[model samples]
Target: MLIGVPKEIKTHEYRVGMTPASVREAVHHGHEVLVETGAGAGIGAHDDAYRAAGARIARDAAEVFANAEMIVKVKEPQANERAMLREGQILFTYLHLAPDPDQTRDLLKAGVVAIAYETVTAPDGSLPLLAPMSQVAGRMSVQAAAHCLEKEQGGMGILPGGVPGVKPARFCIIGGGVVGENAAAMAIGLGADVVIIEKSVPRMQQLHRIFGHAVNTVYSTRLTIEEEVLAADVVICGVLIPGAAAPKLISRDMVRRMKPGSVIVDVAIDQGGCAETSMPTTHAEPTYVVDDVVHYCVANMPGAVARTSTYALNNATLPHILAIADKGWRQALAEDEHLLHGLNVAYGHITHEAVARSLNMPWTDPHTFVRD
Candidate 1:
């Protein structure tokens, strides 16, 4: 198998699909890797490093896309990259197709076998591939909110961890999953008053056990969300519905009623945000005022810490990449039911049910394409 690693093209996105170490492993497995020149620059791994790892460096993305059987990327293909995709070519990356009709349409039109890292599952029903980045994003959300709280950044000028006599900022996290948990950890570490709103009884109990008196766990309800939003100095929207678009738990009216100078870090922005006013922002301009509240909705928060993000993501994704490379995607997916869940589109059909339903497209079971 010949695999291609292309430099991520998304604005402010710096992570690469494969690291030098990943290329070495693939090469050891008798797979040839073609990496775009400077693809690993963000992670401090240069062309020489890839060459030393047995990967041939391509002069441009066009050459990598044209020659490799499988294209490994950190982010979804941009318009030009999508145009270069050929039928039957495998695209393994984060394709937030549920909210992006243009991307879904392009993938279908290209007829490529699209495997989304975010939708890939583990044996325990956890999103293994998505976890690392979620962890990074969750931690970063607090950091971003703290910065956004500065008066110059349109915030309330309150400190996350207040001075001797002042009260610390209040943080409301909308989900108790990996993102929410990590955010809570960071916020609690900063001595901020934290509240996590969760729907799952078991998960809420687990959060209580983990945080104890450090944080509050509330049962998720419309009234609760509204109340929390109004009182919070910073609201971190970490809600997720797997491959589907994130539910809008915070409405525009809710945003308007929130205290002035409050900040919202919508960590779920990648799956579409949990807030009605949330729109994708870039690190270049990561925030905007919405009814006197600030929103930090960068779609690729992990990209800001490219080196750590790349290594963490590669750790989770390398085994799956090797599996598909060694066995072929069809055979590998057929053998591993969890891997099959990662299939979003193949042969012009939507293979993931949640993504299909979100896009109002017909869903085809992934099994239909993995059969021997």
Candidate 2:
């Protein structure tokens, strides 16, 4: 099997699909690795490093896409990259197809076998591939909010951890999953008053046991969401519905009533956002003022720390990538039901039910493609 690693081309996305270490592993597995020239520049890895790792460096994406059986990428294929895709080529990446109709259309037209990292599941029903970046994004959300809290950034000019005479800023985190838990950890570390709104009773109890008096846990309700978001200085929206679009828990009217210059970091922006007013922003211009509320909705927050994100993401994705390379996608996916869940589109058909439903497209069962 020949695998291609392309440099990510999304707006402000600096993470590459495979590191030199990953290439070395693939080579050791009897798979040929082709990396685009300067593919690892974002993570400070040079083409020579890939060469040293037994990877052949290609001059451009066209060569990589044309020759490799599987294309490994950090982000979804851009328009140019999508145009380069060929029939039956495997695209293993984070394709958030729910909110992007253009991308969904292009992948279907290309007849590519697309596997979405976020849709892959573990034995425990956790999203293993998505967890690394979620952990990064969840922790980064607090850092972004902290910066947004300053007056110059359109925030309330309050400090997250206030001085001796002033009170610390308050934080309201929606959802108590991976993102919300990490956000609470960061906010609490800074001595900020933190409240996590969760719907799961067992998870809420777990959080209470973990943080005790350091953080407040609340049951999620329309009334609690309204009251808590309106009162908090920083509101982090981290709710997610997996391969489906994120639910809009915070309405535009709700945002309009937030304190003047308050901040919102919508960590769920990748799956669309939990706020009605939430729109994707970029790292170049990460924030915008909305009804006197500051919104930080960068779709790829982990890209801001490319090195850490790349390594962490590679750790989670490498095993799955190797499986596809060693045994072919069909055999590997047929063997592992969890991996089958990652197959969103194949042979000009939508394989993932959630993604097809989200896009209002005809659904094709994934098993049809997995011939044992």
Candidate 3:
């Protein structure tokens, strides 16, 4: 099988799909890998590195796309890249299709086997492919929230870890999943008052056990979320419902109740957002003010730290890529139930029920696409 790795073209996106190590793995498996020139440069990976790993370097994305059977990417395919897609091509990437009708339509029309990273579950019901980036984004959320809390950034001029005479900032994390846990851990480490809102009792107990007296855990309800949001100096929205759009736990009206200059870093912005005011921002211009509240909603937050993100993401996605390359998409999906969950669209059909319901499109059972 021939695999293509294209440079990410999304605005301020600097992460590529694969690394030199990943290329070497494919090459070792007797698969041909074509990498776009400078595809890994943003992630500190050079052409010579890929060449050393036995990967052919293509001058442009067109050549890689034109020659490869499977295209591996970090983000969703941009408009131009989508136009270049061939029917029945395999697109393995983070396709957050629930919030974007246009992207959903384009993927369906292209007739590509669209496998979403966020939907690829593990045996334990954890999102394996999405975890690496989520870990990066979750940690970065605290960093971004701290920066946005400075006065120059139009924040309250409070320090996250205050001086001897002053109190540290308060952090409210929505959700108790990976992102929230990481953010809360960081915030607690910085001596900030951290509260995590969780819906699951077992998860909340786990969080309590993990943090003990270092942080507070709240059972997420409308009243509790509102109270926490109003009191928090830094609000990190990390709630996610897997492939579906993240629930809006913080409303516009709730924003009004927040302290002036409070910062919101919505880690779930990729799956829409948990905060109502969040729209996609870029790394170049990562923040916008809403009712004097700072919002850091860069859709690709992990991309800001491209090198770490690239290696981490590749580590998680490489095995799945190999599976699809070794076995055809149909065979791979038929063999692995978890991999089948990753298939959002295939051959002009909506194979993922969540995406179909989100876009109000007709759904075809994914099993229909698997032929014995």
Candidate 4:
């Protein structure tokens, strides 16, 4: 099998799909790996490193995409890249198709096998490939929120952790999954009054145990979310529904209710965002003010720290990439139920239920295609 890794072209997305170590693994398994030149440079990995690991360096993305059977990428194919996709090419990446009708249509038109990392679920119902990046985005949410809270950034001029005799900022985190947990940890560490709104009772209980007095766990409700969000100096939107679009928990009207100069970091923006005002922003211009509330919705938050994100993502995705490369998608999906769930679109058919429902497309059961 020939695998390709292209440099991320999204604005401020510096993370590459495959690291040098990941390339070495593929090479060891007798699979040819092609990495586009400077693909790993943003992640502090040079072409020489990939070459040292037995990967062939292509001068351009076209060469890498044109030659490989499977293209492993950090982000979904942008408009330009999607145009180059050919029939039967396997695109394994974070394809958040639920929110983007254009991208979904393009994938079907191209007839490529689109395996989404976020949809891949383990037996324990955990997204292995999405977890590492989610953790990174969750942590970055706080940093972004903090930065936006500075007076110069048009925030309330409140410090996250207030000094003696000063009140600490209030942070409200929506959801209690990986993103929420990490956000809570960061907010609490900064001495802010952290409140987590979670729908799952058991998860809330676990959060109560883990955080004790450091964080407050609330049973999420319309009133609760509205009240807490309005009171928060910084609100982190981290709600996720696997392959589906994130629920719009915060309404446009609600944005007007929040205090002026409040900061909102919608970590769920990749899935269309939980905040009604959330529009995909780039790191070049990461924030926009709506109703005097600053919204930081950089879709690829983890990409800002490419080196850390690359190594962290490789740690989780390499094993699955190797499995797919060695066994082939059919064999790999047939053998691993977890990997099978990741298959979103294959041969112009939507295999993931959530993606199909979200996009109003016909759904095909994954089991029918990957039956052992």
Candidate 5:
């Protein structure tokens, strides 16, 4: 098997699919690795490093895409990259397809076997592949919000942790999952008053035990979200629905009611966001003002810290990559139920139920084609 790594071409997406260490492991497993020239530049690994790791560097993405049996990428294929996909070729990457109809259509047209990292699940129902970036983005959300809260950035000039005699800023996190938990830790560590609104009683109780008197855990509801969001200085929306689009818990009216110059960082923007006003933004211009409230909705917040994100992601994805390379995708999926959940589209058909339902497309069970 030949695994190809192409440089990410998304707006300000600087992470690469495979690190030299990942390539070396694949090489050790007797798989050939092809990396497009400068693919690892974002993470500061040059061609020489990949070459030293037994990877051949292609002159361009076209050559790599044309030759490799499996394309390993950090982000989903862009329009041009999607056009180059061949039938039966494997695309193992983060395909946030529930919100992106065009990408789903393109994958179907290309007849490629698309395996999304974000959709893979662990035995305990945790998202193992998506956890590293969730941690990265969750930590970054507060940093972004703190910057957005500066007066020059259209915020209320409120510091996240106030000085002596001044009250600290209030932060409302809309989920208690990995993203919300990491955000709460960061916010609380910075001396900000934090409240986490979650629906799960067990999870909320765990959060209560984790934070004790430091953080407030409230049962999530329409009234609670509205009240908490309106009163908060910064609201971090970290809600997720696996491979489906994120539920819009914060309405436009709720945004309108928030205090003037407050910040809302929709960390769920990758899954189409949890706010009605949330639109994908880039690190170049990461914020927009609506109803006089600051909204930071960068779709790839982890991408801004490419080196850290790339290493963390490769750590989680390498074993799966090795599995696909050594056993082939069919055998790999057949052997690992968790990996089979990653299959979204294969041979012009949608294979993931959540993605199919979200896009209003028919889905064939992945197991049916695993033996085909």
Candidate 6:
């Protein structure tokens, strides 16, 4: 199998699909790797490093895309990249298709076999490939909120961890999953008052057992969310519905009512955000003001820490990549039920139910394409 690694083209996205170590592993398995020149520059791995790892460096993305059987990328293909996709070519990356109709339409028209990392599942029903980036994003959300709280950043000039005599800033996280848990950990470490609003009873109990008195766990309700948002100095929306678009739990009216200078870090922005005011921002301009409240909705928060994020992502995705490379994608997905869940589009059809339903499109089961 010949695999291609293209430099991520998304604005502010610096992570690469494969690392030098990943290329070496693939080469050892008798697979050839063609990486675009400078693809690993963001992670401090240069062309020489890839060459040393037995990957041939292509002069441009066009050559790599034209020759490789499978294209491994960190983000979804941009317009130009999508145009270069040929029928039956395998694309393994984070599509986030539920909210992006343009990308989904392009992908369907391209007839490429798209496997989304964000939708890939593990035996325990956890998203393995998406977990590392989620962890990074969760941890970064607090850091971003703290920055947004500075008076220079148009915030209330409040310190996350106040002085000995002053009260600490309050952080309200809107989910108790991996993102919410990691956010709570970081907020607590900063000595902030933390509260997590969750719908799952077992998960809330789990959070309580983990944090004890360090954090507050509340059952999610319309009233509870409103109260939390109004009282919070910073609200971190970490809600997720897997392959579907994130539910809008925080309304525009809610944003208007929040205290002036409050900040919202919508970590679920990739799935279209949990707040009505949330729109995809970039690392270049990460926040905007809405009714005197700050909203940080960077779609690729992990990209801000490219080195750590790249290594973490490669650690989780390498095994799956190897599986797809060693056994053809059809065989690989047929053998692993969890991996099959990653299939979003194939032969011009939407294969993921959640993504299709979210977009009001028809879905075809992934099993229809798997051969015995």
Taking the tens digit of each residue's C-alpha lDDT, what string does model 1 give over 1-372?
A: 999999898998899999999999999999999999999999899999999999999999999999999999999999999999999999999999999999999999999999999999988889999999999999999999999999999999999989899999999999999999999999999989999999999999899899898999999999999999899999999998889999999999999999999999999999899999999999888999989999999999999999999999999999999999999999999999998999999989999999999989999988999876
CA lDDT for candidate 5: 0.95
Taking all chains together, each candidate's TM-score versus the true structure is 0.99, 0.99, 0.98, 0.99, 0.99, 0.99
lDDT (tens digit, per residue) of candidate 2 on 1-372: 999998788888889999999999999999999999989999999999999999999999999999999999989899999999999999999999999989999999999999999999999999999999989999999999999999999999998988898999999999999999999999999989999999999999999998999989999999999999999999999998878989899999999999999999999988889999999999999999999999999999999999999999999999999999999999999999999999999989999999888889899999998875
Task: Give a tens-digit lDDT track for model 3, residues 258-305.
Answer: 899999999888889988899999998999999999999999998889
lDDT of 4: 0.93
Off by over 4 Å in 2: none
- Cα lDDT tens digits, model 6, 324-355, are 99999999999999999999999899999999
Residue 183 accuracy (lDDT) in model 3: 90
The residue ranges of model 3 lying beyond 4 angstroms of the native Cα positions read none
lDDT of each: 0.96, 0.94, 0.91, 0.93, 0.95, 0.96
Report, for all candidates in order, the number of backbone clashes: 0, 0, 0, 0, 0, 0
Kindly indicate the candidate among 4 and 6 with the higher TM-score.
6
Task: Give the 10-residue window scoring lowest on summed lDDT in candidate 1.
Answer: 363-372
> What's the distance in Å from true for residue 220, model 4?
0.7
The TM-score obtained by model 5 is 0.99
